[model samples]
Target: MLIKSVFIILLVGLFCQTSYAKDNCPTRKPVICYWASWAVYRPGQGAHKIENIDPSYCTHIIYTFAGIDMDGKLTSLDNHNDIVNGGYKKIVALKESNPCLKVMLAIGGWNEGSEKYSLLAETEESRKKFAEDVSRLMINYGFDGFDVDWEYPTQRGGIPADKENFVALLRALKERLKPRNRILSIAVSASVAVSKQAYDIEAICREIDFVSLMGYDMQATNATSIHSPLKLESSDPDDRETLDQIVYYYKSQGCPTQKIILGVPAYGRSFTLQNPQNNHVGAAVLGVGREGTFTREAGFLGYNEICDLKRTRSDWRNEYLERNAAVYGSINKLWVSYDDPKTIVAKAQYVLEENLGGMMIWSIDTDDFKGRCGQSAYPLLQAINKGLGNQLPSSFSHVDF
Candidate 1:
């Protein structure tokens, strides 16, 4: 009788713990931060490693760009493909060093997402196959879950029926992963597009674990004005997406309040155009590169190079609040886009106001102030963490500064 009582108590305790973990204010809230290796990572290329990482601030690490398969499925090329290429081992090493950090592999990005997602969602078989493939991919590489970076759900001006299909696809992902506990999240834009496309926003919110909002692009690079305003009162005319606005969109659509995570960009965009008066009006890039193309292809500068310039060169200046930091100074007559510390403060406040899920940042290496060529990486990422209320998980608390 005594043993039975003890066992029952233990079971109750376990259940309580599980319930808490699922709560918005779980004793240990997970602040998921993403890192892109495919575009910027290379063996020994980064100056830092997992041990050097300040895990206290970031609870999850998402390795982006494993690429989608020929059949429109998400696949992992980290462990299977030339592992040494994209800091795959370094990422694995980060996980080993930080037990509290749950790692996931992200597939698809803005440019290469959801082309056939609608067609795949049409048939149940296709959805099941996609789920099975995702499970295999995660299990094979030892990841906790998958991050779906589908740029937009509905039409990309290419097709008109992706809205409903997007919801069906999430439902299928949830169904297939039911037996096995895994994470599923969708990357959503902060524009009015969600409402326009007829994306079952309420349904998408119901099926997925959390909604990740890309709220950084309110103002692009270049131009002349406040870009990503944080706390605007409408009548206040501050600028950017307000927390209340974000909450209204999700809540109106019936999305769970606590399950939404706001995204803040670790890197900023750059642009230069003729009339640099308005922030949004599409401008010409004065730098070597142009917008919409890869940095290398565009011929201006890549991430690491930019970082080096920020440090080694005094001429480099970032006008964070102006939304023209990357083009802070005109080399003659031109404009650019990017943020500095001033804007990050507002971004963090938005997270607090809505009581959203968490914050996820773009490619970590790009944020390194030193460009991996100088002293320890600084500034960029640390600023973001500081902005988010510094709600670091206990597991990473012991992490060094």
Candidate 2:
């Protein structure tokens, strides 16, 4: 009887431990999605409003972006009327549906450039003012936190002091937000050359909750190569361009695995083939391909547009490169390199294996919100959720580390 009781107690302890681990997994590994503010105005895409976002699909949604005024203050990038009357309130209202959802306001982006960020981070006074203004903006607009998307700190048109200044700025922001229990995150370059020169990663990581690694665009626009390949092909010149190399680079740089979020593109890079017959991986390209129906970018197509082409265009051929673990589509003289459900699943598995924080999509608005893709709306996002085990029976909440 004594031995049987001891065995029962051991079984109960193991069960409790398993349940606790399961419960903590989703909350600890966040699935952060970015929502671009400009998608509402794309000519043929129609307005993608904040109301359309399904809160359950993402653990956190970053609104891109709020700009920096000349005086180094945070201001809305969109029209004031639209921000006040439409986007701002509707975004905060999402919490009503999913109280676990965290909404963040991202400041600066590729076009915004780094000049203003360099200026703002140059001095203690400027950093303090910027932090205070950001804190106020979050409180006023009901944002849960802030995301700094400085294109490049020391590069671009920024000053040499940007590397140090950026760290100071993060510390200042953290000081203000910590009191309110708010979150702070920064988007950093995934390129080894750029990231090494532009950021003091260890110092910066200490001040923020997570590092949103811009893992896409490793390949140049003029080049005919896979933009976000998981592994380098034999023909590839730079192995650093691969996703595996980028993640390992950050990990080696002293970034805690839990504080690093791998970025996935919701769109693909397209290149016009010099010869339609030579539609292989490293074929030469004349220039950017035709504009997407919705995105309207010459060399870019959102997942929805890609899916539409696959469904309607007979010339469209989807192929997966086993060597790179990436998917690319070809149609006539155009080829697009993008992540499909298969690549997303592989990336999700990598995230779990490495114990990384979670996966982050560039912009949620580019997703197939209308279900026109035939695989259901937000299929890529759904893949990430499934990959991360977010659909498991467990409670998720705003977790800070």
Candidate 3:
């Protein structure tokens, strides 16, 4: 009788342990969303606030970006918005609605440049100081982790030693964050040429939670082309790089497939054709396309801006680069290449087929969150969520256009 009782207790304990492990482990792939703080400044319909974000749309939200000072310490670039006005506090509060959602603070961006990050990573003392400063800021602000967006470690005015030092910097940050159960991730360029010069792929992969591959903005030359293509388009040169080639290159370099998060753009790159009739890809371009009313930046248009153009105008011709898995629009002299819901779904399916970690949106702010284009709100993100085999929560199940 005593032996039987002991056996039963052991069996129960084993079952409980197994159940606990299964329950704690993440069952679905992550949907990482980046929220740009600057979107608050956009006028009228283009302005995106912290409240506009749907917590259900993302598994992880990264706030970009917190700047690094000359002293190698983490600092808020926009104090009035980020700290004084409770931007960080409000974004972190999203966890109340999404218990599984992880929020991280990103440091460095294209505007911040690479030289500052290079100098910061050049010494152990600076790296240690930066890591500690990051930890304190995260702890105080309730951020779950840190995201390093150094652009490219060894280029953009950065030194050659940045290749090894980049890995060292991540190691230091990882060591500091691990004890607190926090995470660390990086955003890396997708270009093979750039990756070769900037990263020690295998080493960097081993240290961080995942690599966010900037799969967009990879136009080969000044010629008008699809900014982000899943595969080489029929019109593309044989040597032109695509998202497919980018993934294969990273994997061949020893980065695990599951550790790579494919980036999807929520904006489009635009070019002004020299002749309105010559609006196809590889056509001649005189300069950047005209800016949007809200975004007000030449050569770029938010998905919201693009969709507005499509909705209000009747003359624009839209085409899907079927072979490449991308889409484009041309009206008069304006040519813009961007991803729509259909293409976003295609990318998400590719994510599952390739066993990638997840999808990372360059930003959620640029998406048509208000549903002004006569489609469901967050159509692109919704496509990604559903394509990844997950359903929207009961609260947001009723999508509005």
Candidate 4:
């Protein structure tokens, strides 16, 4: 009778665990998805509204960009969309569907620059005031917390003191958020060159809930290269720019495994080939590729647009780079290096292998959320969830950084 009871208890526990895994598709890893507010302006099928978001797909959905006012207070950059239209309340309402969802807001993007943030962090009084103001916004708007996206604190017209001061600012913000149990995260550059100059990783990690590492954009060159390669080849000149290198760098610098959130792009980086025949990885480029029909960005192509190209264009062809674990598609003189489901799966597997926090998509809006690709709505995002739920073999090992 004792043995039978023990057996029954074990079976019940196993059944419950299996049920939890199936019900929670993404398992324990958080899928942090950034929702760019401007994506609503994207024409036709590309236009993604706050309602389009499926809160179940993401653990945390951050509203991109609230900015610092000249007076050093938190302010909305888009009053019409963010405030007048009740964007904040609508986004927070997503928690109604998935109570586990953390709706966060980001302040400072590439356009927001670093000068004002540097100034805002120079004094304790200003930092405290800014934190209080941010806390107020979080409380008022029902945001879980805010993300500090100061693009390279000590670079791009910022004072050198920003490196340490950035830490101070985060500490103050964390203090304000901690009492209320709100989250505090920062989007940081993945490049070793920029990271070393801009951040003291150890110090920053100590104060924040997590670090959103912008692992893409390592392909800033005249030649064609993968924008967000998963792994680095020893022969590659920019090996330090790969996702593996950045993750390793942060880990080496004492960032906890759970505190590092690796980022992946929902868009691809494009280049206009100088010679149509020389369409290889290092092929010379004339300039940025033609803009997408919907995104209308000269050098970038959203995953949705890429799907359109694959479906509509007869000449479109793709080649996989096994070494880097990335893919590139070419049509005539236009060449784009981008991530598809395969790439995302590999990265997700890496996240699991490393026991990292989770995966973050740059902007969820750019993903194919309309099912126009004949696969599924939000195909890339679905792939991320799928990968995160996968169980790799015991023999699987991570590549050397």
Candidate 5:
């Protein structure tokens, strides 16, 4: 009896140690951030470049974008200037600052539409040629991988054949990239309608390294509601979107938890409230919100401008909705909904609880790149990193990538 009791005690100790190790392990998932090349030309609000980026913030950076040429080949979108002026080389050089940082070229954005991709994926010949071109581009540009940003597969001016053709394109690219050990990833929509009608989740999971889920933009210009709620609030309608629902939908469709990256926005959706007194979640809106100082967009505000507004405007008051795990502010008729550091931390906690791969920011340029927000530079990113246990070293600048 004495020997048996000792054996049981040892077993319990072993179990506790194993549990602690599993709980405290470093995050093995990738925190991906997208960097827009065109932001360099956006005057005051959009003057961001590869050099402005903090190498420690993200595990992977995707340069957006390289367009599809007339002959279905990968081509530089910036008037061919990015290629000639060594912009691609500058992006690749970032690895010198953070060797663990993987750089990828993202092809096709919303502006590129689905027409070109539909045609490119229609035939085996086109898919093969496109894959070869992408592989060649990666080799020449020193990119670690490529990400496909197809807006939608079966819909969005695409044919029914796109469902299978999309898979074929991924397969072709994977096969071509396998020898070089390069990664292949894709950006997917989080809309329930598109999610159900579009992606072949299981097949895609089988072919790609990871899926960057565009989980924001749930609320469009036409509606005034929470843009990216962690969960639906009481005031939210039945059809209202939430990040939890988006994540679950993908997981249920057979996407592995570790292969999914939750995308967060570094911007906000603004709405011009019809009645200043009725400033609430489902208030009536009068068209888009007023244009922002830097973004110069009617319904959008970057984190920098948003923080500036909260700081300067007397009417602006921050409101944290606990149930929804979202933050928003109102100043009379002007209301802006965005994720603050606290909300980001909560979402990052959600990422860990769900055992997700990691979080992805839409465009790091939209972040408080100048560190004027007072919570340290990249406050939103810092919260995420801390929540995921991937904190940046206090003296990270000492080491080159």
Candidate 6:
């Protein structure tokens, strides 16, 4: 109960400090960048301009690992060898180019899923082993820290006991890695219940350096009719990004205010439902993604795809609801939810207004700057930095067109 009381006190302090901040820096906001090494090094992908990344726009570069190939057993330390040697090379190069940029390793992706995590979290030895592997991996690589992105803690396919086990895992991680002083983070769902169930916010904040709120994917594919935007509209059902409410929940639970990172999707999803004409279609059979270039079960599209769609009348964009920004095209009947430079700007502004730790893109690769889409991720970052950062107007003059 005392822990609960302390949590309330922290919440009170959070509100008082945020709403009345005199400094320009958002005291409670997070500054972040999502970097997927594999995606970045694809043929004619992020590599063409990997060196062109602007560090001023972001404070941290989160490196994602897709795991080792099926050949030899992969040690946690060198599991993601391919991405590092090939794709992440450019990432490391960027760091060499910009000393201020910080890189952290993200484990387990949507495809990789969290099937094995339940087994890993079932016992103390497994949890410790996992943490050791993560710590060793970060040190072995040039990474600054680790972000545990186990999709679900208890719901869906996740293990039922992982709710409390997650906190225990983090506690062990904090104790072990404290000496090394590595950055610790977790990719948690936006759901209030899930966050509450998975980890102790206050305890996690104490151990991990920051918490990246995986804010995207709030939309559901359930049969019920729904109009969920990646960035929910103010009018949507209990879905608006109301700062006071969100912060209240976190602070009340003892989560630290300074280490919160808001997650935003750089790209959108085009959902192919059973009916094309129905605006209230449910579920995503396939993705008529950005620019109609690809379709998978809720697969992602790059910023380039969106840009191309804008020009080519991509089916995904053809029937998008102008008001809700929902995509409703394709004869198969599709509805998509994604973010562009414009929407990205709105969320970035929200970060500033709310004094959140800062924002992190779902991935750096999704932000295509080659004009594939109408806009690029770089400009979006620039907008965020300009909006929330201490950027001066004179700095823009030095940037090459």
Best model per lDDT: 3
Off by over 4 Å in 5: 1-28, 394-401
Q: lDDT (0-100) at residue 105 of candidate 3?
A: 89
Tens digits of per-residue lDDT, candidate 1, 1-401, equal: 99999999998988776555434332343466776554443434443344445655566777776666657666555544326453555565565445556677676676565665556666778878887888776676677777777766665533566677777778878886656777888777766545557467788888887777766556534333333334453333434454346557777878887788766665444455454443333444444325322333332333454555565667554543332222232222333344444455555556666677766666554555343645545455555667765654446323332
TM-score of decoy 1: 0.73
**Which residue pairs collide, candidate 1?**
221-337, 222-336, 222-337, 271-335, 271-337, 272-284, 272-335, 319-325, 320-340
lDDT of 2 at 159: 84
Q: For candidate 5, write residues 351-395 as lDDT tens digits.
A: 999999999988788888888867578888787788787856443
Candidates, ranked, TM-score = 3, 5, 4, 2, 1, 6
Q: Report the lDDT tens digits of candidate 2 across residue range 1-401.
A: 99999999998988776566545544535889999877877766545778778887888999888888889977877765346567877887786666567888888899998888888899999999888998887788788989999999988888889999999999999999989989999998878878888988889989999999887876566656777777777777754477778788888989898999988888899999999888877788999889987788898888878888888888788878765667888988989998877788788888899899999998788877777876577888888888887763333343221
Question: Would you list the C-alpha lDDT of every candidate in the order shown?
Answer: 0.58, 0.82, 0.89, 0.87, 0.84, 0.58
lDDT per residue, candidate 3, 178-212, as tens digits? 89989899998878889999999999999999999
RMSD of each: 6.6, 7.7, 6.0, 8.0, 9.5, 11.7
**Stronger candidate by lDDT (4 vs 6):** 4
Candidate 6 lDDT = 0.58
**What lDDT does model 1 reach?**
0.58
Once superposed on the true structure, which residue ranges of model 3 sit more than 4 Å away at CA? 1-26, 396-401
* Model 3 accuracy (lDDT, Cα): 0.89
Question: Which stretches of model 2 miss by more than 4 angstroms?
Answer: 1-28, 44-46, 238-240, 392-401
lDDT of 4 by residue, 163-280 (tens): 9999999999999999998999999998888999999999999999999999888785789988897776655784447888889999999999999998999999999999999998
RMSD of 3: 6.0
The 10-residue segment of model 3 with minimum total lDDT is: 392-401
Q: For model 3, what is the error of residue 184's alpha carbon versus the real structure, in angstroms, after optimal superposition?
A: 0.5
- Model 2 global lDDT (CA atoms, 0 to 1): 0.82
What value does the lDDT take at residue 380 in candidate 1?
A: 52
